[model samples]
Target: MPRHDGGEKPQRSCLACRETRDRDRLIRFVLSPQGEVVPDLDAKLPGRGAYTCIDAACLAAAVKQRQFGRAFKREVAVPTPDEMTAQVAKLLLERVMGYIALANKAGKIVAGGSMVGDALKSKNKPGLVLVARDVSEAIGEKIAAQAAGNNVPCRWVLTKDDFGALLGKAPRSAIGIKSSGFVVQLLKTIERYRNFLGEVQ
Candidate 1:
């Protein structure tokens, strides 16, 4: 599985901007059997690989300037910028959700509103506070405030129903991740997605 982390990462130059960045900061691409360019989100695809900054304009620049053809050393079909960007965003979002599930299974997740609130106030604070979108407005605001007071990152992600479905349990209004590994990677990936979408993190 691919991940975003604070630790030193593999660096590569973007085929579009020709700028060097961490591997997690760029999206990877590879040539397909049918002579077309495809995104290798996992970075596990075989053969030579191309990289691009996670920006729509950069992707467009690559297509317009024939960067892919030059890098791959052959002609290859590439999707329109809009199509490619959408696909990247979709894959990134899926990775985020998958991490949440893995964390829960690893027993690093603290679920339920009361438990999450208590965890935030304890000496051993959680790495992150995740508030379901469907949580009660008052409860959400309170938890958000608590997290802010504790200098914790509070991200409103999937709804209560969705969280429940993913964890195979009853609805969860709020949750906390206790593992440092999960927190760093989740924060990095969340920021990456937000940056790619031109949203302030």
Candidate 2:
């Protein structure tokens, strides 16, 4: 049943944590047409779906307990936890890149060092700043300071080439995620990726 409070998205319980949360905040999995378990990050796969919290701990629990079989009400082939983590990380990275591309098209992103710096100095600061992992420490520090002054989160996880490919430009050293609807989801996705990799607690 839909939420009586009329929440925008329905809630689902994580098979591992058994805690209910907004569906978008949980990662969905489903039995593929070929009878294999697969992550459905976009939630568009046609089949009975199971969900787990985006944390690696939850995923580990799910795998250790063989919860997928119970969730799907059948025997399902479960991948090793490491393999599943890699798959989720890959899908999350793709989702983040897609969000960046969409935000760029929507004029909600500022790419390149000069533009991002200008954005940081402006009164209307970006909500999130991303520095290329390969950027020099000095440059990255400068950008991080600016973002901190603006009370924004600065991330340095993706490579310069990754940002460039997503923005359809030359390799970018820095980028800013301006205020937009994508900011929340993008941040959540990034956090989930970090959590999955045990980078964050």
TM-score for each prediction? 0.79, 0.82
For candidate 2, what is the lDDT? 0.86
List ranges where model 1 is wrong by over 4 Å. 1-11, 60-66, 133-138
Candidate 1 scores a C-alpha RMSD against the true structure in Å of 4.9
Q: In angstroms, how far off is 102's CA in candidate 1?
A: 0.7
Candidate 1 lDDT tens digits, 23-107: 8778889999998888887789999989998776777788778899999999898887778778878877787788888898888
Instruction: Give candidate 1's error at residue 47 in angstroms.
Output: 1.8
The CA lDDT at 145 in model 1 is: 95
* lDDT of all predictions: 0.84, 0.86
- Model 1 residue 128 CA deviation in Å: 1.0
Query: Candidate 2, residues 66-91: lDDT per residue as tens digits?
Result: 99989998889889987887778888
